[model samples]
Target chain A: MAEVRLVDVEKRYGGFLALPKQSLTIEEGEFLVLLGPSGCGKTTTMRMIAGLEEITSGDILIGGERVNDKPPKDRDIAMVFQNYGLYPHMTVQQNIAYPLKLRGVDRKAREARVRETAEKVELGALLHRRPSELSGGQRQRVALARAIVRTPKIFLMDEPLSNLDAKLRVSMRAELKHLHHELGVTTVYVTHDQMEAMTLASRVAVMREGRIVQLDTPKKIYSEPADLFVAGFIGSPSMNLVEGHITGGRFEAPGVSIPVAAAERGDVVLGIRPEDLELTTAEAPPIRGKLYALELTGEATLVTLREGATSICARGPAEFEAEIDAACALAPRPGARIHLFDKTTGQRIAA
Target chain B: MRDRSLQYVLLVPAFVIVLATTFYPLAYSLTTAFRDWDLTRSRRPEGWVGFDNFAHAFTESHFLNSLWVTTIFVVTSVALTLVIAMSLALLLRRKGRMHTFTRVVLILPFAMSPALIGVSYRFMFNPEFGVLSNGLAAIFPWLEGTAWLADPELAMAILVLTDVWHWAPYMTFMCLGGLASIPRETEEAARIDGASNIRIFFGIILPQMKGVLLVTAILKTIFALKMFDQVVTLTGGGPGTSTETLAYFIFNVGFEWYDMGYASALAWILTAIMMTISIWYVRMLLSERKMATA
Candidate 1:
């Protein structure tokens, strides 16, 4: 419904800067997720957009209108908090109808909209129940219903589904994707879970201390990470990085060596995801070591190899079996890509 | 001894203390309320008067006057204190070093004894050479040298003011606790949901604060009914019993006039009032808890 733009936005707490000067544009009807670890300023950016936190510098525009001076109510945005933020005193019906009521909606229209929204979230039967009487997932649905009831110009979700159980989180993620598609609202979501960001965001803005490290589609981000941090942060069984050196067009660690396109280097970190490597019967020349640990993950087997001090893990077939200390060999699956990063700067090196 | 009996034994000291301090006086007073035991007329209790003393209270002008005064003081002081406390809590709940210092300073007024507060206000409200009286006169200009403690209405106002000043800070801390229990997200979500600040407070914050406010109002009501310390130290039931609360009336009836039977009856009446308020408070707490976990 509206484009949310942050032009050179910055946030500081006294002398400590929470978010450095930065700019970002969330296209209208796009789902942008700011993903990072705990102290990363992603939430700070979301709060600034919500008008909950004051921007230390620069402008924030929504729908081409500068909202830096406007109070949150004037910004015409709705948020679903991490805790759902349901009004505990009100029943689900009232909670969903609250936004309309604030705009002076009549009783009949309010009730009709409330019922329709409740049914959308599959919460019609629980409309008369208070938040205290609902389970965690049901409470999350109520929060979702509340935000979508009035169809504001923007939706700000601060890790809305992080509090649910593992199984419920997946289902809720799907529901959120569907909701975004249905509403077509410009949404800014903040979260630390990379998986959620990868699935739910049209573009994931991976943030570090105070700035976005990479702003790209999830597929592009996973395939071509901007740097060492992004390379190691995105994947499930994160990209394996073994430190040694790139000498004579080869990446060499303690017990591993790989052919690379990089020139001779003294020290570098070689990155490879577990899924990109294949386990073999100890006849390869790339990764040769003692089998450290083998884990069966239902669909695949994770085999870790250790020699002296370094360890590397590879995803093998589910039927793959090995003795704990027996010799192991792993090689890049024919067309897999390898990543090389400089040791000192933590920036990816050309390969 | 077994653990079961030891638990009972451990409670013995507390039970004895309660029996001696609370129940004993209550029992003695109930017995005295039914008898003509004027200390000036007899060394011990006189013949049983049945309902005479209790009935006399319904017709006694002074008793009725004290009841009316007490009602006025309780209603005004409790309402004012609750409003002031909740407002202070809201303002002081902001995140800042200055707000923290202000919250810490709010406890000082509540820490002072109510009797001490009364004495301080008495001195401060003096028409002559009093800082508050002269300062107010200076600000208004139309009024100068108005006798604050000598006028009935003004005296009652000062009494209520002293009580409110003494108690608002404590109630503010309670309100702070209640406010703290509400997640900040609720208010922020409301704001993002397009509700104005005033709307958020009245519709969201206040409704959630019902239990705390109710308990504060009832507790303050009981305290106001038993407001005797300030009456003694500040106004001395001054300006023709304008500030004479029920507790002070009972004290006067018993010690001042030596009307022991009537005083005992009056004390029972005050206790009954406090008990009724306490029962209501307990009921509210139960329902609030039920709503919380429903």
Candidate 2:
């Protein structure tokens, strides 16, 4: 419903800078998630957008209007906190009707809208129940209902599903994505979970140490991380990183060497995702290693192999068997997916 | 069988102590309240006056008057304490260096001994040299000849005000503990829901503090009901017994008048009143819990 733009936004607590001059633009009706680990200023960014935290420098523009001086209420934005923050004292109906009441909606109209919104979130039965009496998932639905009832221009959610259990978190994630699709409101979600960001966000902004390292589509950010940090951060089981030097167009370490993609011919750290390492039975393998351990995780068996003294994780089919200390062959497939980064600068080397 | 025997064996000493210290006195008091026994009389009771003592004490206008006074003081002071304390707790909850200083200064009065507070207020309301009267008269010439503790209205007012001053801070401290325990996200959620500050306080913070407020209210009620020390020190129930509380009235009857029989009956009446109030308070609290959780 509205495009949110941050122009050189910054936050500071005394001498400690929480956020250092960050800029971003979230398109209208786009689900853009700011993703990072803890203390990475993702929540601060969300709060600033919601008008909960004051900006130390620069302005926030919502729908092409400067909102730096506006209070949260005047900005017409709704936020769902990380804890789901349902008012425990009020029934679900009251919680969802609060914003409408603040806006001076008449009683009959407010009740009708609340009923409709409650039904949308599948909370029609729970409208009379206090938050304490509801389960985790129900409370999350109430939070969503509260946000939707207002029909605000932008929705700011700060890891709202983090408090739910793993199974509930997954289901709630799907529900939230569906809700965003149905409502089509510009949403800025903050989460430390990369998988949530990857699945729910149209565009994901990866942050580290108060600065955004990469901002792009989920697939682009995951397949092509901006640097050593993003490469290590985005994937589960993490990408395999090895300290190797590029010499004579061949990347080499102790007991492991693979041909680089032509341009990265110098000392560079080699990065490959766990899924990118292909295991083959060819006699003259491009690289050879010995399996150190194997973990059977339902769908696939994760193999940890050691090339000389370095350890790398690789995902193989469930039927694949590689015992500890078994001989194995390794190769980085021919593509630009194999990332090379400068060892000193941590910057990705252009292929 | 062995477990039951072991439990009974462990309970024998505690049971004996309870019988000796608690039920024995209660039985003795019941028995003695029916008699006209005193120190002057022999150890053995001579006669049973059966309800005559109860009749005598109930008929005494002084005892009835003091009972009414105690009720007024208790209800007013306790209600005032809760209102003022909850307000102060909410005001000081957010973090700051100034908040810390204010908290320490506020809690200082509650930390002082009750007897000392009584003595200090006595000097403060003294007619000639008291800073309170001097300052009041200096600012308002209409109070030039006013001596607070001598006036019946002023004396009763001073007692109630001092009681609030000495105890409201303790309630504030407890309410602050309750406030701090409420999750910050819940409050933030309410704010984002567009509830105004007053609405949020009444609807969210106040209800969440119900348990702590109930307990503190009971305590303040008890303290005010036994309002003796300050009353005795400040005016000694003077100005023709205008400020005579139930506790002071009993003391006056037993120690000053030396009417042991009448005093014993009055003591029993006071005990009955206190027991009834405590039972009612506890019942209301239980019902409140059921209402909230149900």
Candidate 3:
């Protein structure tokens, strides 16, 4: 395995900048997940490291040797594309063995390695079948097998689980975690799925508009987002962001008021996670609004409340029941953290 | 009318045209191929000659020579066209201003009339004051006065060249369509797998292009087997009968020699060859579909 480093990398197509100058270092055997929305330059960053795309200005070093000028083949890296990229004309075994074959491995050894890789991916029976005959999940395994067949210095996976069904993606994600544990190759994985990054990454690099917005361990980043964009992005049902203000050590908006230790600012956005908010029938909770909707999600009921133009969703107990348009009080659960940010700049404000 | 009847009614004009233009001539040719008819002798056909014209074809040296020439031309031209067309297609597949312009210009070669292409090549290869001939002679002093059309091999080579130039552009478009269907990720995966550009093309891209290449080869082969316009316009059966293809020989047999019966038999043979090739093409397509499902 090898450590990968990108120094002052910049990418531009004509005059359009795809990636601004940025630097990152992925230590040996680290599974660094690049997480962002589409067109956020997450895939572009990984491709530049893989040498599949040309960096407008940068130095990419794998194992301390600059690979910026090297072609993908010479970079000693393997990539699994989102579509799997399995060769339709070849059997699964042949597809996995292609890397070893190109390196001039003999038939006897190639077959042995192919067999071992096939079995590792639970694809022994399907080795003789072409990609056309395989299901989506099975095809994804073939792509994984192809990347892991040979011992490359690094592995690049571009949303490899994105093509599989929801259930299949969960199972394959576990498989990938297991594979990385066993092989420990320095891997750069690109995906927009927060759960994948949270579960699989040693560190998550959340990107936005060609820049790394936050880079930290998943748990730390999830609990302590650097900015408003990240706090709103990382959670499901999304974090409830209410545009309010802080005046006289109290945060206030329409039908809501919260005592927070912050300087008086007319334009401030309050951020609270759904799970962190508690729905109550008390007279004056920190958040008060008319019930907009109630949705039962198996274990819990998500109570959505609206005050004027702003909507807030609070995850309440599963047994909780309420009607739409009823006045509801939502208080931050005891000791639950409330995040504040400057509304205009979207930067986190100390609270 | 009901929709079903309306569909059939709409096809009436095309059906009548096919029957009058295609089936009638086909039936007349089949009957005449078995009869003795010399247009110089009489306007009407004579008594039945039952395989006599077919037998004469096998024994006739002119017919045998034309068959040999046609085989050489078809084999050379088809192989050359496929290679050049596929290469051009690959080159043009990349997106750039120049590449787009080149792809548009590619149609010019295929769009020109075959007869006109022949006439142009003939003039271009003329030993006296021809641009290409004089240019080559100027570059190489040893080729000061070489006669390009007079030599049997050179004349046949020129015929194949003109045919390849005329057809490669059409086949190149076919190859481009095939190339587009292949996912870009597959080639990218190959590159990451340590395969060079050459290996990716031959190992990945070429294997996927099999169906398109087969179709192109069959079409070009059929076109080559019946080549006549270029031979007539360029060499006029030249210095000898060296450039005369099978279709050209059939024209000579029926028109110049007034041997209509034999010409009809030869035309039937060519049609049989084409029919057999078309059947093979269909079989290949079926197998390709089967492979896809499998």
lDDT of each: 0.91, 0.85, 0.91
Q: What are the TM values for chain B, all candidates? A: 0.94, 0.87, 0.94
Q: What is the TM-score of candidate 3? A: 0.97
TM-score of chain B of 3: 0.94
Model 3 chain A lowest lDDT segment of ten: A279-288
Which of candidates 1 and 3 reaches a greater DockQ?
Answer: 3
Give the per-residue lDDT digits (tens) of candidate 2, residues A294-321.
8889998887888777888878888888
Q: Given candidate 2, what's the lDDT at residue B55?
A: 92
Q: Which 10-residue window in model 3 chain B sums to the lowest lDDT?
A: B285-294
Q: Best-fitting candidate, measured by DockQ?
A: 3
- The DockQ score of candidate 2 comes to 0.55
Query: What is the TM-score (0 to 1) of candidate 1?
Result: 0.96
Candidate 2 CAPRI classification by DockQ: medium
DockQ for every model, please: 0.77, 0.55, 0.80
- After aligning candidate 1 to the native by TM-score, how far in Å is the CA of A157 from where it should be? 0.8
List model 1 lDDT by residue over B39-96, tens digit each: 9889888999999998999998988999999999998999999999999999978777
Root-mean-square deviation of Cα positions for candidate 2 versus the true structure, in angstroms = 2.5
Q: Estimate each model's TM-score.
A: 0.96, 0.94, 0.97
Sort the candidates on DockQ, descending order: 3, 1, 2
Error of 2 at B236 (Å): 1.1
Query: Tens digits of per-residue lDDT for model 2 on B137-256?
Result: 889889877878888878888888889999989889999998997877777766776777888788878887887898898888878888888877777886888899999998887678
> Candidate 2: misplaced stretches above 4 Å?
A262-266, A334-336, B1-23, B38-46, B291-294
CA error at residue A313 for candidate 3, angstroms: 0.4
